[model samples]
Target: MSEPTMDHHRWGMVLARPRGLLTAEPFWSETADGIEEGLQHTQILFFLHQVPGLQEELEVYRRWSAQGFVHGVILVNPLVNDPRPALVDQLGLASLHAGVETPAPGSASIVSDNVESTRRVLERLHALGHTRIARVSGPSHLAHTHIRNTVSRQIAQELGISVRIVAGEYSEESGRRATAELLGLPAAGRPTAIIYDNDTMALAGLATASALGMQVPDDVSLVAWDDSASCQLASPPITAIAQDVHAFGRTIAQCVRRIESGESSFEVPEPAHHWLRRASVAEVSPPR
Candidate 1:
């Protein structure tokens, strides 16, 4: 097919996130909000959509490219060996990605410091004297999820502690199920503390633990990634890894600006995140 006419455009850029209740979470929503605010003063027609699936996403790119209706596409919830980046290149659409594990060969990236974040979360738990830990992680194929699991395992080995990761789909049901499974393990094998990949799951885990008659921090400690009002408003506010998500979204906007300005592919600098101590974490109690 002949090259896209490149003569007309209906939208300045687009972003498509994976379809799920997870997409309704604070992280992606806030990021979109920030990007919009960041681009507010300009006329960069930004489009954020929750397409049906991967194939639909690719089709959006193709349709938009064919119509010369989109100038670029933002890729989020990237997976290991993600194909969207390459597809964007194939369509000659400018692009930006929200991850770095598999770099977008020709796109600007706002790489979250997942490895560092994972380390900080683990180190904080370890320092509190919790030796047996478990994490309720997101889908296994997500690049960030895999990175967190791998890094957490490495840190666990270094600390000589036991760490187990359970697969979760970033939903209430998954959280409840995974938490029950972890908490049901024999006393000798159960974790003393738990980490959740998102506040939604974390909240569910907290409820599940309580439904099972376990007290947060007292019976089982909890930590959540991607802090939110729900996490903060829980019975005993859950400890969480907090980042300036609004600022993060603005940063992605900046990357979009720079990418449009013809800047070379580069990683946008992201602010560091920290573990927010709350009522949900405690040093492991002495064994009877």
Candidate 2:
């Protein structure tokens, strides 16, 4: 019996942390759907790996590239000092990256304006008189997370507001722990507003606040990033920064198609992040 050969007609997307952002909500699923819809003739193959090392993951991509299993690959959640870009270039493969602004010269990139978006979030909090704000951020190593954190601190200093940030793994458990720690601070030192890097953490924060007998808005205002249906469905409906994941997916797919056609480098318009005001944030009142 002979081994089956590679399928050059297929495109690949490699993702990590599939449990939280990927399968926990419909946003990523919608993105996947959009990708397939955009590529009528090409089959999209999704590889979700639960690994602790990125080098191992890159090895998988390298093998696929060498075997010609996929025409191109999409990489997400880029890290600082990312080696994947160089690896892909060495392999002579077409690649696209999300959550990264400046990819390697030969690869394309899709990314949101994190600086502008973080400034907008801080501005909103400041307008509500949230002088002390706390942020529950995702992993510190990810390029997107670093961008958000840096911009947040810079904006807070400019606004003359105090800000505290705690690291999380973008999981419900991490969210709960971060929220508990933030809420445990002395009343005078505690933040009046809290922002989460994603909806899962925001939901956990809501639950943690409830357990502490704290009222939303009245005690602590809450905001979430990467808005999804889950955010709107939460009690009081979390305030969030919304991005069109479906459109983002379609754009990546289009870029992949272009790369497949021998285009070396091109730009894909990243979806805009906009704040959606809801019941979670309220104007602070002066003490009696």
Candidate 3:
């Protein structure tokens, strides 16, 4: 029997750590849209649901390869001790990794400066006089998350600010829960500024703060990881670290195109990420 050949005009991706509303989530959706735009002619599809573990993801890859369902795959949210790189290579699936700084032996990657960017966020918050801060971060296992954790810790210590970190699953519920827990603490112990992992969670956290009679930026400040239309249209626009998600997606698509065109493996640097200052962040007041 002949081996399965490339599935013409088709490529696949599975959302590694999905936000609650995968379809509605602006960042990923926008990124996917960009990928489509970059692909121009090729049809691209994203597997939106969470696939649980590497074995499952690999299984998906195997089935897809065996059936010739995809020409390649775009992987995001690389895990700590990731084996997908080597595994994908072994399975003969053309792959491109987004959000990876260092890829495995002979694999393609798109790198981002999560460490420096995270440090910059903390530095900005500290500059605003936010002393006691809290971070509602995404899943702990993601490589990006790991980098942020390390950087946040180091920067917080260097700046002499107290930072409490909590894990979330990129859901509104997780944000609400984490925010409530932080706000319920004694005033002296509670964080005055909260940094959320995504816009959805940030919006929920803001509402949670308000429901508890807390005034945004006055009683507490917030900074979201990804900027969104919803974040901007909120009661007070959310302060966010904005990256051109669409451009990043398009870049991913371009890399895949290059790989398919016989460019084996190469590293593509991620686009710039910057802060979107808005009403949600305010300078801390001097104690009475």
Alpha carbon lDDT at 61, candidate 3 = 82
The deviation in Å at residue 151 for candidate 3 is: 0.6
lDDT of candidate 3 over 1-288, digit per residue (tens) = 887776655778876544346754688788888887887765545333357566777788888878887877888889998877777777777888888867666677898888888989999988888889999998888888888888899999999889999898788899999999999999888998999988888999999999999999888999999898898998889999999999998898888888877887688888878989999999986550
Clashing pairs in 2: none
What local distance difference test score does each model get? 0.81, 0.81, 0.84
Best model number under lDDT = 3
Model 2, runs deviating above 4 Å? 1-7, 18-21, 41-52, 286-288
Q: What is the C-alpha lDDT profile of model 2 across 163-251, one tens digit per residue? A: 89999988888899999999999998899999999888999999999999999978899999988788898888999988888888888
For 24-56, candidate 1 gives per-residue lDDT tens digits of 478878877888888877657677766646777
- After TM-score superposition, the amount by which residue 196's alpha carbon in candidate 3 deviates from its true location, in angstroms, is 0.4
User: Which lDDT value does model 3 have at 1?
Assistant: 86
Clash totals in order? 0, 0, 0
TM-score of 1: 0.92
| Reference-based lDDT, residue 182, model 2 | 97
Error of 1 at 14 (Å): 6.8
User: Cα deviation of 272 in candidate 1 (Å)?
Assistant: 2.2
